[model samples]
Target: SIYRMNFAASLCKRVNIRELVTNVPAYAGATELSGGGLALVFRRWATKKTAGSTKNGRDSNPKNLGVKKFGGERVIPGNIIVRQRGTRFHPGNYVGIGKDHTLYALKEGNVKFE
Candidate 1:
């Protein structure tokens, strides 16, 4: 389109045919070569961009942290009673706390909470 405009501008400057081309109907399409006229059609337009990455690596994986055994549930020694990150629930009686604050059964018994 720019090339056509430059060619038309140069031809118009050299031949002095702007007066004749300006009066022609838009639907006429092209002009006679001898007339040294220009017919321009512009139809380019902006469009919406496609979707990019919807997921990211900033999100961490699930830790699966929570109570594993409920109150009144029977558990043997070494059975996990609760999985936690802090002292949310303190161990009592036959239960023991792990280094990461998890609670496990130390002997066979029913679970309890206080």
Candidate 2:
């Protein structure tokens, strides 16, 4: 289903999303807001198993290594606009048309939209 797919995409450490039609910079880019243009941004992250060695020769504790950002764009309906990408669409994220453009963050294997 689209909802599940969107949720999986959001689970990715880094993602780039853009609105169709107008190529406006959206989330993850620029400090200022464009108001009516779509935007897309990419985010990336690295992780480590643990800080200490375990009996199984593996790190039991996990740690965040680093993160990177990328840019993306998409077209809407018929307009050929290049907007910044928004958060990766997810099940918990806002889906559908019009005001359904927000993605919810995932926590404890569950999705929570803001």
Candidate 3:
């Protein structure tokens, strides 16, 4: 174990990686795991990054309202494809333009607007 650790530490030093192994002594003699040895894995989800000071909870917070449909997605009649304050894309074919300038599917079909 001592020889193996020295070799690994030397290799890591050359590659500029972690050369010092944590809990090396405990792991060096480790073999078969018992039923008591259970490992639990965890993952973190993405969080929004806020900048500057805030006056209230709604200060500089986005409504998270935007496009809901992809170009090749299947849309039903009256299904909103894009939500916008102004006319960004003109409606065409089986699509309709709402008063808010949002684009919605006029019939059941695959979304196919340029």
Enumerate clash totals for all models, in the order shown.
0, 32, 0
Model 3 lDDT on a 0 to 1 scale? 0.72
Scored against the true structure, residue 47 in model 2 reaches a CA lDDT of 78
Q: What is residue 16's positional error in candidate 2, in angstroms? A: 18
Q: Over the stretch 14-103, how does candidate 1's per-residue lDDT look in tens digits?
A: 555565454444344454333435544444467889889866668779998999999899999999999999999998998889999999
Task: Mark the regions of model 3 whose C-alpha exceeds 4 Å error after superposition.
Answer: 1-61
Report the lDDT tens digits of candidate 2 across residue range 1-114.
999999888876463443323454434457554545454444556777778756675566753221111123322333212122443432322222223333222222222233
TM-score of 2: 0.18
Better of 2 and 3 by TM-score: 3
Give, for candidate 3, the lowest lDDT window spanning 10 residues: 16-25
Which pairs of residues collide in candidate 1? none
Instruction: Please provide TM-scores, in order, for all candidate models, with all chains considered together.
Output: 0.50, 0.18, 0.45
Question: Which scores greater on TM-score, model 1 or model 2?
Answer: 1
Error of 2 at 14 (Å): 29
Identify the leading candidate in terms of lDDT: 1
